[model samples]
Each structure stands twice: as C-alpha cells, then as structure tokens.
Target: MLALVSAPTNLGLRPPQPGSVPGASKAPEALREAGLFELLRVGGAREAGAIVPGRYVDDDATRPPGRVRNESALVAHALRLAGRVGTILDAGDAPVVVGGDCSVLVGIGVALARRGGTGLIHLDGHTDFRHPGNSGACASVAGEDLAVAVGLHWPAIADIGGLGPYFAPGRTAHLGHRDDDERATEARDLLGAVVSAREARQTASATTAARIHAVAGTGYWLQLDVDILDPDVMPAVDSPDPGGLDTGELGALLRELAPRAIGASITVFDPDLDPDGRCARALVDLLAAPLTTLGSALR
Candidate 1:
C-alpha cells in the first residue's frame, strides 16, 4: 500500500499571504483536489493525511529567536511525520509525501537514512547548501536547507530524527541545477559529482536515468524543488532562476527514475508565487505519472 503524507508548512521562507500571492493558498488545495490522494487510495491505499507544521510567522524584532524556534518546530514536525511514514514503510508500504517546501527533505532524508544508506537525487536550480555565515545577494535560510541535511550546518538543523550526515557525498546526486550562488558553489565543491542543467539538457532522459541509477545503485529518494524549471515555463517560485528543464523533459526523467529507484518523495515550493496556476498544474502532471504507478502497484 502507499501512504500519502502532506506537510503544508513553509519553514525556511514564509509563503505569501492568501489573495496577496497569486496561487499560494490554492496550491495545496489543488494537489488534494486533483485526486492526488484519491488516485493513490483507489487500490486500497493504507493511509493518508495532511500535516500542518507549527507556524512561526516571520518577525523582525524576534526574527533570530523566531528562526531558532521555527527550525526546531520544523525538525520536530518532520521527525513525527517520518516516524509515522517509517511505520508504514516498516510494514512494507511505500510513503509518498507532498510538501510545502524543500525543507521537508530534512525529515525524509533522516527517515530513509534510518532504514539504510539511501542515495539522493536532488533536482533543483540551486544546490541549496548555504554555510552558517555565508553572505550572498539573497541571504535566505531556504537556500541552505540541503546543507543542513548533509550536516554542513549542525547548529541550525541537528536534532531532526537523530539522523546526522543524512547522506554522504557518494550517495547524493544533483540534476537540473542552472543557477549557482556563492553558497551553492561552496556546496558543490564540498559534495562533488553534480550534473548541471546544461548537462541534463545535453543528456537524454535515458542517460540521466542511467546516471542516477548508477550513482544510487539501489534504493534512493528524490528531492524535487519546482524552481528547477525555467521561470518562463514555471514563473511561480520563491527563487526562480532562468534556464531550467522543460515540463516534458522533467516528466520523462521522473517517469524513468521512479521505477528504477526504490522509494521517492517530492516537495513543491512557492506555489503562492504562481500567477495563473500554470506552475501548479504542471507540477501535478509531472508527479501524477509515477504516483499512478505507485497507485497501481499498491492496488
């Protein structure tokens, strides 16, 4: 059976307020309404639920303190969710998690790591590994989430699921990264063997699939950040960069990878930034392919 989980909290960055942001509030609803879970449930899916992370509304005066609490809350929530999902996996069921941001990977990585050494296929425009004191044009915590998961920044993200160094360099691979900030560059240097967007474009989907399969060797988790798509093609994102994979290419890659990898999860961010639901729908379609397989298998 497949257990679908939803984490609707944007921890590192705040999702734009409803009505103010074009499609933010409706993104999660769209996922649910699109029959994402219903499709999974069609074949006697074991369980499903949406989790609301504790809100830590950003405040200037209490920003520092708030971040401390917010990170803790996010970690706690992730651990709780991981434990729940782990329980399902222990019983031989696959877990599919829908997320509000890439930060949710902290928990997912830890949970997967607990089962065994799991490989990572991180699909994003940026490496998402900001060091503790790294300064950049956009100094946002969201950019550093991958670093935290990999144990680059311990203080900020240490206690999530008691899993440190969630993934090793050899166990991790990146695809569709077009833009690189200083922090991202540092992360790439620290963790070698990342496939660039140009390379992904030059390489066929089959080649990409082979590379991921080779690197992962066996079971692995897929961390998808919607910002990896071209801004023109997917305009709604907290951090949109130009020159990313197209919908068709991305869908093909996911479809190819899903069957090869042992387990996987996806995260969608900044849906509020979407203007006309173009990005949201595209994301849903991209995910629907593999999810349908999961549904069929469990059914």
Candidate 2:
C-alpha cells in the first residue's frame, strides 16, 4: 500500500526577493488542486495527511556560519516529517511525499536512518552537492541536501537525532543531474553511481536499473526533484535548467525504480511560476502511475 504525505515547506530555499517567500511552498496544494490526490485515491492509495512546517523566517542577515536559511525551522520540520513518515513505514505502507522543496530530504533521511541500512536514489537536475568542502556559500539546504544526506555537512543538520550519514556515499546513486553541472564530476567520485541526465536519456531503463542495483541495498529511498524534467517541460521549479528528462523519460525511470523503493519523495515544484496550472497537471500525470505502483515488486 502507498500513503500520500503532504509536506509543504519552503524553508530550504533562498527567497526570490529578500522579503518575498518562494512559491514552492504552495506545491502540494497546487498538485492536489490538479487532482493528484483523487487520482492516487482511485488507484488505492490513502492519504496520510500533511506535515505543516514552521513559518519561513528570512534570517540570513543574522544566521551564523554553517547555518542555512531558516535552519532551525528546517530541522524542526524534518523531525516532525520524520515522525510522520516513520509511522507510515511502521504500518508497512510506502509513502509518496509531495512537498515544498528538496529540503524535505533531511526529514526522510532522519526517518530512514532510524531504520538502519538503506540506500538512496537521487534524481535531480542539479547535484545539490554544495557543502563546506566545495563552497564558501553553503546557506541553502535545498542545494546541499545530497551532501547532507551523505554526512558531508555540518553535524547540526546532518546528525539529527544523532543519526548522521543517513545514507552512506557507497549506498547512494545519483541520476538526472545535467552533464555540465559544476559539481557533477566531483560528486561522481564520491557517490555510488552517477548517471547524468544525458546518460539516463540515452540508456535503456533496464541498464540504468542494473547500475542502480549495484548500490541499492536490500532497500532504497527514491528522491525526485521534479526539476529533473527538462525546463521546457517543467519550468515551474525554482531552477529549471535544460538537458533534463522529458515527461516520458522521467516516468519510465520512476516506474522502474519505484517498485523497488521503500518510499519516495517528489519535490522542488514551484506553483508560483505555474500560473495556468499546466505544470501541475503535467506533474500529476507524470507522478500518477509510479506513485500508485511503488513497491509492487515486494508484493
């Protein structure tokens, strides 16, 4: 069974303007309005309800070194979201978390870390690998989640609940990052596997699956940042770069991976940029099948 969890948070993103909030926070609602919930319900999924995050605070001016924007709030939300996801997992239900942004990975990491050994399959257009080791400007968890998940970050965010290195670098596979990403080559050296958007687009799903199988432990988590889709198809994200998967390619990859994933999270869609709801509808269409069919192999 699959449980749909709503995680509406934008704390990890830098504000579009100093005083303005990012629209990614409105993603879950927009997706629901686009009939995502109803489609999943009809496909035999149940709603696990929402994990409302603390209000976003623009604290960059006062934040200390190593602290990201809304750092405390982001951690709080992750702990709470972890609790929710843990409950769903405890009941033996796969969770499909629809969220505000990539920062949600911290909470998912917390939950999975408690369960002991687990792997991760990260799909995104950017590496999200910035950390203290690579950049002086490491203020956004959204951009640093992969680094945090693998424990290449400060202890505060990475070691929540004393559970650090949520997923070991050897157990994490990265897919869909553009070939030209600044950190792609460096990330390739540390991660379990690196399949760029260019490669994923050209390779067979079965071949990609085989590569992922090498690093995916007995079980794994699927993290999807919808910006993995081409900017032409999914420009509603905060950063939509070209050289990403098209709708069909993304869905194919998801269908192959979801059946083996214990749980999954979809993030980084900004409703603010999607004025006519076309992106939401497209996202709903893209996610409907895979979300409903997660963990089917186990059954």
Best model per TM-score: 2
lDDT for every model? 0.66, 0.91
Clashing pairs in 2: none
Give one digit per residue, the lDDT tens place, for model 2 in 1-299.
88999999999999998888999889999999999999999999999999999998788788988788898899999999999999999999999899999999999999999988589999999999999999999998999999999999888899988899999999999998887889998889999999999999899988898899789864699999998999999999988898999998988888888888889999999999999999999999999988887888877
List where candidate 2 sits over 4 angstroms from the true fold. none
How many steric clashes between backbone atoms does each model show? Answer: 1, 0
Best by lDDT: 2
In model 2, the Cα lDDT at residue 81 comes to 94
Error of 2 at 183 (Å): 1.1
| Model 1: per-residue Cα lDDT over 113-232, one tens digit each | 788657777888887766555643222345666776677665546445466777776677777777554455665665635777778888988988887778765566777777788888
